[model samples]
Target: MAAPRWDLGPAREPLGLIRALQGFFSVFAFATLGGFQGSVSFHLSCAGSPNISVSAPFAYPFRLNLATFTPSLTALCNRTWARDVHLVGDFSSSAQFFVVVAVFSFLYSLGALLLYLGYLHLYRGAGGKLPLGDFLATAAFSFLWLVASSAWAKALTDVKASVAAPLPYCHPPAVICSRDTTTPMGTLNVSVVFGFLNLILWLGSSWFVFKETNFHTPPAPSTPSTM
Candidate 1:
């Protein structure tokens, strides 16, 4: 079977438009929600640690889980990049994770939606060369999912420590982290969830789009057929 063309054909303009539109919207959304701010993407809570936890209010001593793991946990916590914070809403953080997860959650959703649409259009439209734009749009969506998922996974933890006493607002009544976060109906939470599913959907869509991309990517110039 002949491979697909990478030229993007006549659909180039439309596909490019899609890519540009998505990029513009993503940037706009992030900017609107303060997602661009580096500091906004983290949350912090230190229940234990003289050497591990950061400067948090209402210090609560760490409770050792497995004595053997104490040193490992401490090492993880003390990692220099563990500057805890949150992107969407202030959530407690035992580690410097989830900030990007929440923010990219929204971004991923956008990517998934676009990639799906792009595939639909690419297949449904008249046969033409798909331009670089086709590949670019699909690529962006895939990347968005990858980023959001990584951040999301990193932030997952079952351990909850009351690292903060006098439970402050948005603290989940425990040391969820020292970040000011969502209240269920809050805007940031909504956006983050949206981004999460968006990423998930995009992952699904991206797989298909990648297939479509490959399906359409032209085979290398055929050597003149031997007589």
Candidate 2:
């Protein structure tokens, strides 16, 4: 008797959803458009008779203008200062956070695209059965992305705090005071939001794969009749 063959079924909705999400992530990661791109803006102001203000805008993955404080506030107050006080914070911390997000997203997106090709008949035209190796890879990478996204979100919060927190020189009794500082956090916030969205989608895909593989079994081959 001939051995049994694995039966393939129609593609599941969850799998298609996962493929769609993967494509979306790939675009965002490569283009760095929509939520992936962000900028930080800081304004320095000294409180005295006439308020003096200077604004600096910083783009992510490029330059980060944390906090620029004019050191020679006394000179400015006395009209003896030739240049504006310069204050800056180490932007490496936040830059690193964004870099990690971009790199991982790109990698995950590429993996997902390859898997999609396999499923769509573009690559190997693999059947509907979810392979064990693929499942394991998906689960592992999904978890990694989840954790990274969470970290990215937390890092954004930290960046916001750092932007708001007064620097050492700006302590009370200091001539140069940080009158007001604000950062448009929409870009980073959107990235963090999408991260959670991707995490949920990945978990759902994993669960679907697990159920399909565990509950459904291919029919066994029937014995051949003797002529």
Candidate 3:
């Protein structure tokens, strides 16, 4: 067989443009969430002692429960006062799920773009199967994006709550502890936005893909003159 002809025309169409956007947003969604590294800070003060700074660092796959923060030894609060302080919850599951979905979406869109650009003939020759398959994949990813984004959003809310709540160790008598600051999660917030954008892109492309499938074909007109 002759080598498949390369065509750039499809790359300019709505379906192709949407696929490109999906791939673009998918990259940002995963990168922002996966590469995140931040910390929550606190202030510790005991009666007659100056305030001490403590920080608990955390990164992607946010298992805050595993993260520990210990205050520096002060004259009033010695090593005996030092203890591992853990944040309240584990949100790794939702974070990982969101990142994984975005990564797979990027890979799929990249492959689909290659097919549209380099193997147009083969895709068209697949007897409606290719387009139907693409439509199904698009629908599936749309649902996945909805689920992953929602779950991650809820998880992020819990993460903020866990960080903002007073540390359990701060409850002792005469020893005062309070949250100082938390590294902003702007990147992760952007990730959530991109995730929803991907969902919209995939859903919008589904109509174009469905048009190519047999399911979307209009029925033949009736032979009215036969009467």
Candidate 4:
């Protein structure tokens, strides 16, 4: 029945800071990984034709197996080239999983921050249910970040290998193919770093939120009896 009171005190506390960081880093984690667009180049040389360069472009949800690149020349050095050359690997599952977790973490952290800043009284008055829910959500996010980041890291490794490896059609004796260049994945690497950082922040904040719950209260000590 009372008017809501705004309090800035919680924003200065450790839990609030952690939530802010979780939201901040989550933006970078998903943005970098989701907005990523890069390509792998290959140089082709045949017995007598001029050297040809081709690049296969790949983007978010990185299904390399579907990426296609056409060489400049249809027929070169007495050999015909496929119009649509595809790269290898299907890493969409792991990449998407990582992005999804980052996105959700960002949304949850933002909402929690709002509640802490504008609805502190209501939160405190929730009879321990709010804190218990917060603790559980924090723990769940910590675990999710771990799984998503680890899976994405491994998938990224395979993606790099697939891009760098020579193409199957180039194995013929008449043609030779070699890697030319690979777009830098520095942003993606940073995304992984942010993911783990979020994991650490969420894991650390769990303890603080747990303390607010009744479960973390110490049992009352019984008075010692003396005769």
Q: Write the per-residue lDDT of candidate 4 for residues 56-108, one digit (tens) a residue.
A: 89999999998876554356545456555688889999999999999999999
Model 4 is weakest, by summed lDDT over 10 consecutive residues, at: 71-80
Q: What does the lDDT read for residue 169 in candidate 2?
A: 42
Question: Total clashing residue pairs per candidate?
Answer: 32, 4, 0, 0
Positional deviation of 140 in candidate 2, in angstroms?
A: 1.3
Q: Model-by-model lDDT, in order? A: 0.37, 0.51, 0.84, 0.85
- In candidate 1, position 215 carries an lDDT of 63
* Weakest 10 consecutive residues of candidate 1 by summed lDDT: 58-67
**Candidate order, TM-score descending:** 4, 3, 2, 1
Candidate 2: Cα lDDT at 213 = 46
Pairs with steric clashes in candidate 4: none
Compose the digit string of candidate 3's lDDT tens values, residues 94-193: 9999999999999999999888888878776777789889999999999999999999999999988887777654544567777788899999899899
Against the hidden true structure, what lDDT does model 1 obtain?
0.37
* lDDT (10s digit) by residue, model 2, range 109-147: 566555544443422223424444556766875776677
Q: What TM-score, computed on C-alpha atoms, does each candidate reach?
A: 0.32, 0.60, 0.88, 0.89
In Å, residue 208's CA in model 4 sits off its true spot by 1.0
In candidate 1, stretches whose alpha carbon ends up further than 4 angstroms from where it belongs are 1-21, 32-185, 197-227
Give the Cα-based TM-score of candidate 2 against the true structure: 0.60
Model 2 backbone overlap count: 4
Q: Tell me how candidate 2 scores on lDDT.
A: 0.51
